[model samples]
Target: MLTPLQKTTIRATVPALQAHGDTITRTFYARLFAAHPELLNVFNPANQQTGQQARSLAASVLAYAEHIDRPGLLAPMVQRIAHKHVSLDVQPQQYRVVGQHLLDAIAEVLGEAATPDILSAWAAAYDELAALMIDTERDLYHTGTEQPGGWSGFTPLRVTRLTPESSVITSLTLERPGGEALPPYQAGQYVSVKVKVPGDDHWHIRQYSLSAAPNGQQYRIAVKREDGGVVSTHLHDRVREGDDLLVHVPAGDFTLRAGTRPLVLLSGGVGVTPLLAMLHAALTDTPQRPVTFIHAAHNRAAHAFGPEVRALAAQHPQLRTLVFYTDVQDTDQLGLPSHQAGFITAATLKPALPLDADYYFCGPTGFMATVEGILDELGVPVTRRFTETFGPSQQFILPAAALAAPI
Candidate 1:
């Protein structure tokens, strides 16, 4: 526990953190990576390139400062991050490296203005937060190991099947070397796939959601090829069937909640991967659960798993599948769109959805924002609404403290 004076000192730094948090975090990461190059294997370079990782770190630090006294507010976000850390097999030792560089970065950025009291208070805060994360990740790591067919670290799996789902997305099936049984993960969980870049000793690790139900035979992941993405490019062009790749145990907290409430699973573009798993899960586990699977894409040519969703909806009356084509193709639906013409908005969706339903949505930032607005306007309880973002998440924006930065 920090002393009252220390807490005050810590709270005082919040303004500077809010003003220059990204610069501090960017410098911290650069220094950390320069000191410990081996960690390049753990963090996603794509996130680094896009400044997502720095921004995420900056947000987390400011959020912690905002709610330092009432830590309960940070619990959910901490749990979510702990699962991600567990997927990368992150250890407690790494936190020390991060903490040291972070403090050094603040000192460098603030110059002579970073006082001893402020630095010490920030150090205490960092230690407190790191302890919480480390403990949570430790429990997560242990839980994954204790589960059936689970292992501690990276396990080698052979790519058994490769099939293109759309022009840009491909589904790859992975199985253990000798047809070994893999651990079963929750419907929306993901595994960290480590790829060996050509001529590089260090491997690039990327997490992909398991796009299929747990069948005990193989785990399937849908990967979308992105422009200038290292892991996606490697997986799309270099790797093929019969090739081997290292993967960590599946981990995530954005899972389907168990209840009798009607399920609304929505997706956009390639965000459909995890939601597709949840859809199949509802089919096998809860046959009576009413499900509405809505998806939005640029056009029919970009839609993945369209045939499967259509086939399921055709056979099952309880399952309703709706597709929205923002840019309709000439060959799509006899030169027409599917159900809707423009984006999936409140005007287009308000009539079909039940207010009491359990809503699970995954999509880009704009898509999630739109869904959040629609749900809010419909007066759906916060308890029933769940969402997860595809790329760098912008989900939780902490209540900002209005304070001006000092010179």
Candidate 2:
């Protein structure tokens, strides 16, 4: 436990810390890579180029300082980052080195403002925080290691089936190369897929959330073709079943919160993947919990898992499903009340949502931002708004090098 004085000191210094957090994180990563280039195998260079890794590091530091007094208060944030760390193959010993770099970066960035007292307090706080993280993550790493096909880092797996869901989407089933069973993962977590694209200098790694409940029979991932994007386009154009692909262990904290509160699942297009798992878990594990699903797709053809979602809704009395067809034939349109003609707006959703409900949403950034803004305007508490950003590249930002690099 931190002393009262220490707590007060941390609380006051947080703004200072937040102001320089990104700078320190930036410096820390630069120093870390300079000292330990081998760690690059665990981190995605493209994400680094985009500054996502820096923001991730910065968010952790800020969250730690913000919740220094009551460390337990940071449980959810800790769980989220721990899963990311595990996927990155972050080890306990790595924390000490990271701590050293972080402290050094802070002192360098803050200069005279980082007094011995300030430095000491932060060091102690980081040590305490890191200990908690290490303790929490060690169990996860152990549980993962003990699993049949799981290992400390990336391993080779063969794609078993590549079933195309639509013109732009495909569902893949993968298994360990030796027929070993892989580690079981929670519903909405993601796994890192590393592929060596032809004519590329380095391997391209991306994350895709698991699309189904873990049946222990086969792990599944749904990937969408990105015509304008590099890797996704390659996966769609060239990737095939029976081909070997490298994958990191499953990790993420976007799993469903077990509670009795009614769930309002809002998804748009491919955003349905993670929520599909959540919906599946809700149907099987917590069937009594009321769930209302609202999905928006470009058209019927672009709608992924339409039949399965309908089947689940049909089977569960507590489930209410609504779909919005952004594109449909005028002649065949049902013109149903639940079937909205276009996008899902606050007005369209008002009838389906309970006055008091816990909402979970997943979609493109624009869609999510729009819904979040609408929900906020409608007086939804921030705590009740749960969301997940699908696909890789963490939170968005442009790295210094990328800014300097000529187009």
Candidate 3:
């Protein structure tokens, strides 16, 4: 436990943290990789190169300092990080390495400002946070291993089949070589795929949402070919059926809640993967429940699972799907029940959406921000709106009007 002086010191450094957070994180990563080059195999090179990981770490550190006394406020953030850590098979000892480099970076950046008292306070704070994370991850690891058909760490699975979903998206069906039953997972959970690219010395790991509902026989994940993405490009261009890949147990917190309220799912681009699973599971479990799925894509060619979603909608009267195509082709059919040109706007959503429905959306940062703002304008309660970002934790900047409104 932090003494009163330490807590006061941490709170007083909030401004400095905000100002130098990014620099500190960048320095930390540089120092960490220099001293422990093996860690490169465990982290995303793309995210690191683009500075996304550094920015995310910086934000997290600042938030932790600001909420040191009220740790309850950090529960959501902690849960998200813990899940990600477990998916990566992060070991407890790595925290010590990280803490050392982080503190060194802070001191190197702040120079004289980082006095012995402040440094000591920060070290104790890091230990406290690290202990919490370690405990949470231990519980998660236990639950995952204890579950039926679940295994700890990465397990090798053979890719049984590959199906193209769209111009840029493809689905890979994976199953155990021994044809054993697979563990069940929540509809929106994701699994980390670990692979060593042909020429690379290190491994690359990426998390893809399980695009299909649990079948107990196999697992399906949809991969979108991202530009210059190491794992994605390798999966799209080189990985093949009959090939084996290391996959972690399913883990995530962005899942569908069991309830009787109307369900509204919104997605942009490849974010539709998890929402698709939720739709399938929800329909199968509660066919009578009303569900509205809204998806935004570039065009018909970019829209995945279009035929399957349309077929399901045709078969179920309670299901409604609305597709927004930003760039409609002349060959695309208009006036269809599911087709709409342009992006999702308040004008389009207000007429059909239920105010009391549970809203779940995932997509590009801009798209989610817009959806949140629109939901706020529609007077949807904060508790009913849920979202998931694909990569790093990006803060959703609400519109000016929405910010002014009461929570």
What TM-score do all the candidates reach, one by one?
0.93, 0.82, 0.95
Over 1-407, each residue of candidate 1 has an lDDT whose tens digit, in order, gives: 77788888878889998899889988998999999898876787778877888988888888788777777777778988898888887889988888999999999999887988889998998899999999899899888898888889898999999999998999999999898798898999999998789977897888899999999879999999999887898999999899999999899988988887899999999899999999999988888989999999888789999998988887888898778888987777733233676788787887767647999999877888888898888788676777788765644543223222121
Residue pairs with clashing backbones, model 1: none
lDDT of each: 0.85, 0.78, 0.90
Displacement of residue 314 (Cα, Å) in model 3 is 1.5
How well is each residue in 226-246 modelled by candidate 2, as lDDT tens digits?
A: 646566787787888898878
lDDT of 2 at 152: 73
- Predicted structure 2, TM vs. truth: 0.82
In model 2, which runs have C-alpha deviations exceeding 4 angstroms?
Answer: 1-9, 34-52, 147-151, 178-183, 198-205, 226-231, 259-261, 298-302, 314-318, 325-338, 381-384, 391-407
Candidate 3 yields a Cα-based lDDT of: 0.90
Clashing pairs in 3: none
| True lDDT of residue 305, candidate 3 | 91
Global CA lDDT of candidate 1, please?
A: 0.85
Candidate with the larger TM-score of 1 and 3? 3
Q: For candidate 3, which ten residues in a row score worst on lDDT?
A: 394-403
Better structure of 2 and 3 per lDDT: 3
